[model samples]
Each structure stands twice: as structure tokens, then as C-alpha cells.
Target: MASENMEISLPLELHPFVIRVLDDPDLQQRLASIVEAKAFVEESLKVAAEQEIPLNAEILASTLRPDPLGLGRFTSAPLQMDNWPPIGWLPTRTVQSQDGTPAFDWVWFGPHRHSRPFFEEDVRRAEAMPFNWLFRVRTGLQALISGYGSEPEVPLKGLIFHMSRCGSTLLSQMYASVPDSLVSSEPEPLGGVIQWIRLAKVDQESAITVMRAIVAALGRDSGTGAKYHLIKAEAWNAHSIALFRNAFPSVNWVFLYRNSIEVLVSLLRQPAIHTVENLMPREMVELNDEEPRSREEFAALVVAKIGKSIITHQHLGGGLVIAYPDIIDAATTSIP
Candidate 1:
């Protein structure tokens, strides 16, 4: 966070910095390595400063994340976490706080109407409020297990898996369209914890415990609804099917896939964060540290990797497979 007295102003010339920080691979790598949030901001300001790109804390802060649920006067009033309601706090990221214990940072996503492709577009907005940097809060890993605000009555309906550019979001949306159902597509905290688990940042028992906590939080039941809980994991998350299965054995699941040629065309036209180099860890997608022949080729391999993982795990008892063309029908008839 910039000093409160640092003249909260963003120069016109620095407007492009927002787009650059999120879209530029090198810039993301440079900032992501910083363990401390404040240090991260300071380094970001310096990057723009050294390049002679006019910038201020405000401008830089706005591009750090998605959803403007920060504790600004203009934003929603935040309820204290002491007895926090499940619906009020949205888990934003899984992080190890200054204490070195793994935890999750939460933000507000009120009843406000939101943009589509929630994680992709909303997170990409880089929408941040200065207040967020000043007073962010973290719910320790135990809160997830100690019984969050409240747990939904029903067990998870099913998990939604997909190759990106496929109809996973569409199907999840369809499920959300139904009355009393809550479909969270590409949950960031879940994705974040999965990465950390793979990186060995957390032990196995704790990882399983927190994952259950996360799902329970997402499945919060406020006494009346969300009888159906469906989470659409990221394309690369196919590799974690066993993790989810281990943590949620009885929960049903479905994997949606599409034609590779069409998937490649979609990526070539507009690359997703996972497909872009440095945006995501290569090891998460089974790629070696050596340079890929091409970004396009790398993306294809990533898509193939996800497909192979899906094939390897789709036979996990309750799991079902659905092709892109048959998604709507499959979701309608196949998902119970």
C-alpha cells in the first residue's frame, strides 16, 4: 500500500499499466515472487517508476485483482469476521499470512450484478480499492474446518470439469439458472490451494482439512437454499481429480470436453491465463522447465494434458463424461 499521504492520484499516462500488469507475462512473474503484499505493491510502483512510466499507488492498486469489494465507502459495508455470515465474505485468495500459516484472504461480492465469466473477466479487471491494501483480513485455515458460518444441508451435487473454451461455464450457468441452485465457476481459492498443495506449501492432512473447509464455505446454506452445489474447476484442475475425490468421495462429478481443433482456435484467438506462459506454473500442467517450441504448441500440449488426466480419472465410480456437443443434453439428463 502506498503511504496515505502519497497524493492518491493516477496519471493518465499510467492507465496502460493496468492492462500491462495483468496481460504482460514478465511483469506478472516479477511481482508474483514477492511474498509480502506491501512489498509486492512497492516493487510494482518501482517497476513503473524505473521504466519512467508515470504511475501512483492508486493506479497500481486498481490492477492487482478482481471485484471491487474492498472496504471503501463506495463499496459494501463489511461485516466483521468474528461471527461473519457465510454469504457476506467471498474467499478471494489462498495465502500464507505474515504469520507463515496458510490462510485465505476474503473480499465482499454483495448482491451487486456482476460481469460474466466471473473469474476470467472479473479477476482480469484488476479491480482493486486502496482500502483493500490497508485493511485486508484473512480467515485462518482452521475456520474452514471449525464449521464456517454454516454448511449447506446437501452434499455436493457434482463437480464440473472441462477443457477450456468448452461448455463447462455454460452448463454451470444452466445449473445456476435453476431455482435454488448455486453454481460457482472456476473458484479462485480452490484453485489457489490446489496449486499450493502441489507445491508442498501445505501438508497432506492439513490440505485435505482446508479443502473440505473451502467447499463447506462455498456450500454455505443460509437456512433456505442452494440445495445443489456445483463447482467448475479450471481446465488444468483435471490433474487434481484424485485430490477432490479423496476429499469428497461420495460426491458425483462430470467432465466436459470439446474438439481439440476448436479448442486450439479459441486459444489462438484469445489466450487464457493458464495457456499464457508464466501466468500459471508450468509444472501444474506437466510441462518441463525447458522452453516450449511455441506458445501455441505449448497450449495444445496443455489441453492434451488435461484431456489425458480426464481420461485417467473419469472412471472414478460416480464420474461421467460429456462431449461439448452433447453438454446441454448430458447436463440435463446425465447430472442428477
Candidate 2:
């Protein structure tokens, strides 16, 4: 089969220091190999597109859209994994810390010979990439479709929106304990789907595809006689309610809020999480010189955004507001 033309452009200019390092022949060769692998992956996707194969939600969410940074450069050629390391190049993994403590793992695959922990900047870049957004949309769509048609013994009650560290996870776990209920915690598909929604040129078909996939997956997971599928997404995805409502108008929504100060304090203390980049204004950063203060302000702004989003959707009906304290108490009682 003839290969389709595939191109991915990087969002940021390469740092001068990094550019100089690429002068080395060895590094250049390794980088070329990585590019080749990306091309091979893209080719395979082209074939799938040509064949009109339905993509699973997980794959759709991660790969279809053009990355903002143009890093969606997977190869269409077959990969020769025989010589690669057994662990191979999987997306970042969570691993134990050097001190034997539990820590979030941040791994990457590239031409660079040495492996080091990714910093906040690296994560921000990854999140901005178009491919990452595409992957999320594809995956969420697949999951939704899988869950939709199955017999729903239990009607889906509603969805909950929250800020991170606001006890949302705890709340979701609690709701899962209801008889015949299913709960999906911080599923990756939502993130991918939302990324596509944020693009200037939105594709309604793609959005519908994703929403259907998530709903279907939820239904299937809940089983034939099960009740609701409570989906708890990452705090950053609070805006997803808009997309969800667009696709499934009748689905109810519940937005959760907490004390801004407390939420900020909790997020800053965590390692391996990305700090704000393009989202925050320069003035906001300048006012809060300290990292903690900056993080607090950022969290406050994000929470405000989430609140506004809820309000915007409230008029449509079936939206509720839940306090963090109430949610925590509810979770404690609900979870077995």
C-alpha cells in the first residue's frame, strides 16, 4: 500500500542548548530512528482510516487530532520490538521513588541516551501536544459507544464536576458502592475528548463520536441490571460538562467546589504534577513570587472557571451544585 503524507510540527522552538547537542552524529542518528518509528505508526493509521475501521475510545482519544505542538508523529511502519528494551517506551509510568516511597512515575521515549525524571515543563509540553488530545478523544469515544446500547438496569442519575484534592475521588468511590453501580476514576478518554473541543475549528461528528463511546462504556461496565456509572475525571477537565451536554443533552450534572486556599495548598505539595504555563497571565505570576502563592492563585482561577462553566450549563436544567464537605461525608458513608 502507498504511504500517506504525514507531518507533525513542534510547538516550541528548540532551546539553543538542545540544538547544539543535536550536532553530535550519534544523537542525530538516534533522533532519526525515532522519527522513522513515528512515520511507521502514522502509516498504519492511514490504512485504518482507509479501511473505515471503527477505532476504540482509548486509541481515538489519543491519536486522531492534530497536536498543538505537532508532536503527534507516530510512524506507520512496523516496529521491530525484538531489539528494544523489554519495558519498552510506554507513556509515563507511575513508579516507586528512590527513597522507597510511592511516587508518580514520569517516563518518556526518545533518542536521548540518558533517562531522567521529567520536570513540570516537560509535562506541560506533552499535554499541549495535538496527538495527546487526539488520543483522549478516540479513547473516550470508544468507551462511550461500548457502554451505550447495553441494558441499563439502573438509570444514570447524574455526573459530578470537581477541583483536584477536593475529595472528588473519594466521592466517586463512594457512589460506586450503590447496588449494581460502576465508577470510573479519572478516565483518560475525557481529557482527550476535551482537547479536541477546545480547538478553534470544532468537529461536531468527532465530538458526538466521543460522547457516545463514553456513555456506551459506562453502560456496559454497569452491567445489564446495574444502576449508574459514576465517572470522575481529573480536575483540569471540569470544562468537559459542556461537551458532554452537547452530545447527551439529558445527562444530569453536579459541580463540586471547595475552599480555594485549601485546594491550592494540596496541589502544590504534590510532586510530578505540572505547574501552570500558557494558561496563567504574566501579571498573576508576578504578583505571587512564591511558588505556593502562585499555585494558590492558579487554583483559585481554575476553580472559578469550573464554577462559571457549571453556571453556564445550569440554565439548561438538571445541573446541581455539591459542596466539598458534603461530598466527603457522602463518600465516607457510601463506600463499603
Candidate 3:
């Protein structure tokens, strides 16, 4: 087979570094090696397909795989695995296939102590899945087509939104504190769906459908007396309020924000990924019709956008608004 030099375009964020590396012959050789390895994998898979080897979901589920990030080589069956680590598990991220279909990769967690925060719990998960690539799993594509059929204990209890630096994590910790609550703080699959929806790679209808399935998948009752299923989205998810509501209209929603300066300070001390300018699409950023020139300005714009979303949603008769200071009190009284 003849090999052609493939021109790859870097994302806007990477263009500067990419330009610097463009002239490096070593980099070019490394890129070519990647291409050659990809071609080898494709040819191997093609030979397997020609031999009529089984590549269904069941087989894929049991087999070990080297390419965790690639979806094209697998069959259509959606991926599922048993014997997930003791603390329960969650999808780490979603990847799109050549056809633009999304698939999730699940990560297992170690035991989580009752009093531990989400970050600590995550640390436990990472410990359990240590150097995860060493122990691999094959995932197929049909799972989504066949429907993973993740059954929720009951329907989702509600959605949580917030401005960056607000105590949404603490709020999620409080919810997790409840013996019967299943609180998923920013599962990556939902974030992927939101991005897919915004990019028009996935339609609103399909996005809603996938969102419901994901919530259900994550909302498992496990006979553990889990009554309330709460999903805390990424802070900037305020931008997609309507899309989410469209998916689960009856699910109550709440937006949490702090004083502007306090929020600004929190962000300045440690910035969230979404606060980077041009990181999000223009429509989603909603920077008050102004382009921010600096990181601080971008953080300010994001905070303002979140506040505006909450107030706007409140006026639209959608959901409750909880201030940062009153989170505990509001949770005690307002949240049902």
C-alpha cells in the first residue's frame, strides 16, 4: 500500500506550539510512526474481519485491548464490564468515532469512606485503577445501539449547576452525605454530550436521549437504599440550562453562586479549565457581548454569565437559586 503524508491541523489552542514543532524533523518522524502504527492496526483488523473472527460485544467485553482510545476497530455492541472495583465506578471520558458516534470508557474506584470528599474519593479510584493502561479492556460500539439499558433506581432527583469556585463540590459532598443519595459530581459523559450538542455533532433529540441513559446508568440503586440521584455538572454548564431541562424537565434544578469578588478571587487563585478564553464556543461563553482580553477578565465574564443564567432561569420559572452562603440552609429547607 502507498503511504501519503497526512496533513494534520492542530486546534487553535495548540497552533502556537504546533508551529514551533512543525519544522522539527524528529517530530515529523514521530508523527509518521503514529500514522504507520495506525495503518498496521487497521490492516490487522481488516484481516481479522476477513477471517470471520467474532468481534461482538460479548467477546470484546471479555478480551483485553491495547487501543483504549480508538473506537473504529470494535464491533457495534456497547461496552460493559462486571467486577468493577468496590467503591463503584464512573466513565472517565467520551470519545467520538469516525461517524461521530460517542462511546464512554468506564473507570473503577476503590472503597470510598463515608466522610471523604469527592476529590478524595477520586484519589481512591485512581489508586484502585493504578497505571490502568497495564490492565486493559476491549469495548465495542454496539452497546449504545443496543442500549446499555442502565436502569435507574428511580428517576433522577435533580441537577446541580454553579459558578466556578462556588461550593458546588461541597454541596455535592453534602448530598453524598445523605445515606440514600447518589451524587455524581460532573460525570464526564454528560459533559461530552453537552459539547457534542453544542458542536452540532449530536442533535438535541439524541443528546437528550443519551443524557437520560447516562443518568440512568449512573443512577443505579444497587439495593443500597439510594433514593435521590443527583448529577453536578461542570461549572460552566449554566450555558446549557435549557438543553438539560429539555431532557429532564421534571427534574428540579438549582444554580449556586457566590459574591462576584469572592467568586473572582476563588477563580484567580485556581482557575477552572472552562475559564480559558476560546476554550468554549462563543455562544456558550456568553461574555456579555464583549471579548475578554485577559485570564482574569475571562474569569469575570464566566462568573457573570453563570449569575445571569441563574437569574434568568429563576425569572423563567424554571428552578430555585441558591446563594453560596446559604447552601446548607437552602438544602435543608428548599431542596425537596
Q: Which has the greatest lDDT?
A: 1
Clashes of 3: 6
Clashing pairs in 3: 76-141, 76-142, 77-142, 77-143, 78-142, 78-143
Local accuracy of candidate 3 as per-residue lDDT tens digits, 108-160? 33122222444335533442332222122222234532334534343577888
Which ranges in model 2 have alpha carbons more than 4 Å from their true place?
1-156, 221-225, 271-275, 278-296, 328-336
Report the lDDT tens digits of candidate 2 across residue range 46-118: 5344545432334433333443432322322111111111111222212222443211111222222111111
lDDT of 1 by residue, 31-78 (tens): 544545566678877887776766677655554443344333233222
Misplaced by over 4 Å in model 1 are: 1-87, 99-101, 109-116, 119-136, 148-154, 201-203, 289-291
Q: Provide the overall lDDT of each model, using Cα atoms, as 2-decimal numbers.
A: 0.64, 0.43, 0.57
Q: Select the stronger candidate by lDDT from 1 and 3.
A: 1
lDDT of 1 at 123: 34
Error of 1 at 317 (Å): 2.3
Q: Estimate each model's TM-score.
A: 0.68, 0.48, 0.66
Q: Number of clashing residue pairs in every model?
A: 0, 47, 6
